[model samples]
Target: MDIPRSFRKTLLAHLPYAVNEDFTAADDLAALGLNSMGLVQLLTDLEETFGLELPDELITEETFATAGSLWATVSELVPAGQFSDA
Candidate 1:
């Protein structure tokens, strides 16, 4: 599925560092210059964007590394009755 542009925009805004990285693809979260705070903010943005109830486990490096991966994870974790910011 084609991911929403809002997801990308929100992620970049919270990134607060080099906004030029190709975040659409899988890359190291640390390599993208995201510190712990940045990652927390990014998690908030993702939660708001997708309306997913995030667990602590979902906030790992692998799950949130890429826009595509993040969305997929959210889609999986977000339950049938879970809200979507649609």
Candidate 2:
């Protein structure tokens, strides 16, 4: 399955240091400049974009470690049939 375009766009907006468009799912977001402050803001952006709230237990360093990991966690929270290629 592909990551939602909204998710990708929102994530990219917060990643100030991201150098290229080829960033992969396993890429480290922090290395791309997603610092602690960015992460906090990202959480809010994600919730508002997806219209869902991530549980407190799900908010952890591991969940935000990589793009793929974060997508996996988000994919689980959002309703099925919501992911699209657009």
Worst 10 residues of 1 by lDDT: 77-86
**Candidate 2 Cα misplacement greater than 4 A, ranges:** none
Q: How far does residue 68 in candidate 2 sit from its true spot (Å)? A: 0.3
Whole-model alpha-carbon lDDT for candidate 2? 0.84
Q: For model 2, how does the per-residue alpha-carbon lDDT over 1-86 read when each residue is reduced to its tens digit?
A: 35667678888988888765556789888888899999999999999988879999999999999888999999888877766654
Model 1, 1-86: lDDT tens per residue?
55445555666776655465345555555666778888788888777766767888777877867666776777686566443333
- The superposed Cα distance between candidate 1 and the true structure at residue 78, in angstroms, equals 5.2
| Alpha carbon lDDT at 35, candidate 1 | 81
- The segments of candidate 1 whose C-alpha lies over 4 angstroms from its true place after superposition are 17-22, 77-86
RMSD per candidate (Å) reads 3.9, 1.6
